[model samples]
Target chain A: MNFDNMRFSKEHEWVEFEKSSEVVTIGITDFAAGELGDIVFVELPEVGREVKNKEPVGAIEAVKTVADLFAPLSGVVKEVNTQLEDNPGLVNQSPYKEGWFLRLQMTDRSELDELMSHDDYSRITGTE
Target chain B: MSEPKKTPLYDVHQSLGGKMVEFAGFLMPVAYGSIIDEHNAVRERVGVFDVSHMGQFVVTGTDAREFVNRMITNDCSKLLPGNLQYTVMCREDGTVVDDLLVYVISEDRIILVVNAANIEKDYEHLTSRKRKNVEVSDVSEEYALVAVQGPRTREVIAACPFFGQVADRLQKLPYYNGITFYHRGAEVLVSRTGYTGELGFEVFVPAELAVALWDQIVVAGEDCGLAVIGLGARDTLRFEAAYCLYGHELDDHTSPLEAGLSWVVKLKKPSFCGAEALRKEKAKGSKRVLIGLAVSGRNIARQGYTVLRDGREVGRVTSGAFAPTLHKSLCMALVDRACSAGDGQFAVWVRDKEVPAKPTSLPFYKSRAK
Candidate 1:
């Protein structure tokens, strides 16, 4: 399920921006996290790292395989989810909340206009 | 979603929240919930897996017995019609093509189940060497493979509606044996074989009835505490069983003798593929031996991580993981013949750190092997 506050990307990542601040949070959608299965390690980008839109910024390692997390918007990393170093499953446990991968200071707000809304994400997923 | 390809229990897996992944061009469940949870589920209780991606082949004709005996490492001549054997398809240098389960269905017919990734390679390899009358045909896409495994798995099979009579007959079935049976209005072919160390059954049925049959078994075994397992659990369980995972443990470049599978080579089984190479290797002794590693701490040594002796690379970890049963790190690797037994453990160059590890006996995790 997608939310109005959450923007979806074709690569299955989601971004949520606070209404008043330019700071935005990113995480994989529940669908992507579920598909990855039992993340054993989470490699987070360092704070102040510049990330390009749709480019790999970090990685998630599952028991069976490994997947890199992509930045949905061009931004400077403001904060990294440090709790993930020991407990990577937080991404699978609450992907939209505490499971957030990074907080970024958005450099391009215009990128949000190109993202898919809840309905488009639902269609892309082909299910609720 | 547009009918790309469906495993026998694809629908069932979806309904149960299986997270599907693209594997070898087939849509298969990587896990249902948490891989660790699913992994533990199969180790502790009865679990079902949709292994329908495995390729099955049919070989039949007048020279079937002789052809199969000369093709694989196992002694096919001694295999009763209904019996099965775990064997390997090898190369000229004693390298294993694939480890497979071969079953003699009748005097003139036999079946070989192979890895999905090696279907074409195995088919082409087998066909290149023609026998007098034995015709080899690929029947992989036509059959659905389902595995029900764990300690309590026997109870589930015993209670399934159509398999009761056959289950009775199967009760006496020893390891590496198989039989064709009727189950739930379907022609069910079952083998007493499994990758997991737990007692289990692998069934092959027509693709058309795969989903329904899987559902019937699940619905029937509900009272027996059966959980629909996934590939995640299937892998972890097998890894814990110390089973040699293809691609990781054995490959075209690695020989059976080096992979610690010399026992299955049936070196005495006259004139099979790579028999000469294997005999030669046996005489010379192996230069590298595949061994098990145990990490004393919680840190895991993953594949591609280099094994170290005094900070120098000695070998590389081929496969490593947190074994659910052992609750510790277990790994398999090919190490140099000169390396002495690790004094209980050693170090692995994992990422930027030298992870502490120990050399454990074969099969880092042990279950019902006997």
Candidate 2:
């Protein structure tokens, strides 16, 4: 998937915005998935719940450790990927596409400015 | 902080892409590539582990057998020359000091393999009780331990020419037995015992020759799909077999009987350290007992999680994980004996919520080997 327009948080979450609908799709970055190893379970946020920027929305558990998933921006959770309930390995197999965690209706459009761009994210993650 | 110690196989682990972590005051590999994959490799094929961080003590002298027998819970008098016995040493209060393996090399000479974290403490405990004509020496720094485990373990070792004449003896070695052989003019002890619940072998080699032996075994077993496993998979493998880890299952405060290791405790032995207390506890019964739990969800119930019965905290989890081979989240907890006697219904607090769990039999997974 092209990460050209997607913005990334330092915690390794990516937010792809749809300007026409004021909605954004969020998921963990490839680097995050690689470091996490095999994902056995993912606890996603409930749809329609309010979320604030940088707040923990859910958790992702691997065989060895557990890591929290943080919201990239302030919004109302519009949808959660229910497929993860039975198949959490999707997060490790395809973190950018099929493994997208949730969709949020953006409450503050300016929050995207605070996130890093594709080039910046890649540089920070040392994935370039 | 001072730098952690490194094993002789440290360079080999790094070159194999093992992710190193600090454990028991040593820089050790937690995983090579993926823990699940490494776990499967051991179950289906064969795998090698660098467990050199474990401590070894050599006890010898005229009174060695009698002295050693009195120190542990198991009957050392029953062990033959090549026999290896799993036993626990306890405080006078019946609580465990550490669980260790005793290799009965001879009537006068014995080797005790102990946990890395408890080396100094265990050595001190052994030396504190002065015995007539007994000599105890800590030989941990002089040796390295490599565990080659799985159904295909014998084939892998036999293929390696570096093992020399001992490679042939590996085929005839029975479980819980060992033999000392010469490797590079140094004495190496090969034992048919493992923690992974598989037909396996643990080789004790001189620290200087450890790297060479590891490389040759890896090369010999390459075609048979032997991967270099780390401590992460090692823990899961042992947990599936319901093996007790030192700090988690058995501790300085927890009795071995409560840890479901009563079979190792011998009450008829005239007298031993903690025997009187253990006998009393046996007669009165224990208040808390270790039981296995199967959580209803994928979220793991980690160590220190509170176990609840009827909305009240009854116990705490000691070790828990998502068992990769079993395809379920399993945990071992020390709960109130009364709570464990019910219809197997209980709950474990994960994060903030109480996840529904049920008591299951110990050893969530059993190996196919005889």
> Per-residue lDDT tens digits of candidate 1, residues B253-325?
8888888888788887758889998898889888778878886554567787888766666788888887767
For all the predictions, what are the DockQ values? 0.37, 0.85
lDDT of 2 by residue, B65-112 (tens): 899999999999989988999999998899999999999998899999
lDDT of 1 by residue, A1-128 (tens): 33878888988888897778899888888888876777777777899999899888766767876677788999999998888876778988999888888899999999988998877887988865
lDDT by residue (tens digit), candidate 2, A7-55: 9999999999866778999999889988888888999999999999999
Candidate 1 residue runs with Cα over 4 Å from true position: A1-35, A41-60, A66-91, A95-128, B1-5, B183-186, B296-299, B339-345
TM-score (all chains, Cα) for each model: 0.81, 0.96
Docking class of predicted structure 1: acceptable
| Model 2 residue A96 distance off true place after TM-score fit, in angstroms | 2.2
Runs of candidate 2 exceeding 4 Å displacement: A19-21, A118-128
In model 2, residue pairs whose N, Cα or C atoms come closer than 3 Å (at least 3 residues apart or on different chains), thus clashing, are none
How high is the lDDT of residue B190 in model 1? 87
